[model samples]
Target: MIIAIDGPSGAGKSTISKMLADSLSMHCLDTGAMYRAVAYLRLHGDIPEHDEKSLVQLVRKTELNFHHTTSGTQIFWDGIDVTVELRAPIISQEASRISAWSAIRKVLVELQRKICGSGDFVVEGRDIGSVVFPHTAYKFYLDANVQIRASRRQQQLKEQGIIKDVKTIVAEIKKRDFHDSTRKDSPLTKAAGAILIDSTSLTKAEVVQKMIIEIEKIKEKLGKKGKTN
Candidate 1:
């Protein structure tokens, strides 16, 4: 089974996707981190986000690998462990911008599909269900109020010892939301046939449980359909 989870940043997609994947004994693919790796490379090279030609060239040569470990999944960018650098605010902003490039998204989406080859994967990203795996029967769109998302983002940063004002984080979140939703290339929207989960008041565990319940129902329905066929 391939599960597609789509949502804006700080909406608990990562946390829920990880827990759900672990519970289902499936691999977890964080597609957003793939975009972040591209941005991190660009920021390292001083390449402008608007430089589509350079961006295309950079992504063409990029290689992303995900490793399951005792600590969790670790992402490698071109053989470098960059899991720690992916969450920086600059990278997040840059990821949101460069991800809008059609060529860049194409490159990453191909890689994403390759990564999920013949495996049960819980893939989470802005466009996974709609673009990356539209045929997947189990798709979910997770969302929360912008303020709640910003607060969660702030807390996540604080946990990592990178504190920023809640207001500042909130503004950035709104800006990124606009960019992600309005982008011409694979804009973020609810995928067709996806179940929408409003996660504002739900704890991470509660959200994961809800998703599991939905999956169970789907599996049972499929089982019955198979028996009839």
Candidate 2:
């Protein structure tokens, strides 16, 4: 099965998706990282901002790979391990902007589909449920209040020894939410039939358990239907 977890930034989609993938014995595909990687390249490389053709050409020439180890998954861009650099706040903002480009979205969406096409993967990103895997049986839209979301992001940055006030983080997140939701290509949205889980007051474990219960219920229903057939 291809399970899609879609949500805005800092809503715990990454952590929860990893936990859910582990619990379900499925590989976790971090689609957001892919966009961030593109953003990283755009910043460090010579790709022109206004040139769509340059972006598409750069992406096509790039060899993006994910290496899974006991420590965690590491993303390599063109054989260079840029896992840490991709998480920078600047990259996040750029990812939000460049991801709106139709050409960029088309390339990355194709790569995402190919990676998860065989199934048994838990994918997380802004548009996974709505655009990448719309036909998947298991889909979730994880969200939280803007304040709670910003606080989570603040904590994450603090872990990296980069301190930022919650207010600044909140402003950045709100801007990202606007860019992501209002983008012309593959805007963030709740796909039809997706279960919305608000993480405003819930722990990560609680959210995972709730999703597990829902998945089990769906599987049981499908099993019984098979028996009847």
TM-score per candidate, in order?
0.92, 0.94
- Scored by Cα lDDT, where does model 2 land? 0.86
- Ten-residue region with minimum lDDT total, candidate 2: 220-229
Candidate 2 regions exceeding 4 Å error are: 68-72, 224-229
lDDT of 2 by residue, 68-185 (tens): 5333468898798999998888898888888889998999898888877655788999888888888777889999999999999999999999999999999988988998899888
RMSD (Å) per prediction: 2.5, 2.4
Spell out the clash pairs found in candidate 1.
none
Please report the candidate that would top lDDT against the real structure: 2
* Residue 170 lDDT in candidate 2: 91
Off by over 4 Å in 1: 69-72, 224-229
Q: After superposition, how far is residue 20 of candidate 2 from its true place, in Å?
A: 0.3
Residue 85, model 1, lDDT? 89
Question: In every candidate, how many clashes are there?
Answer: 0, 0
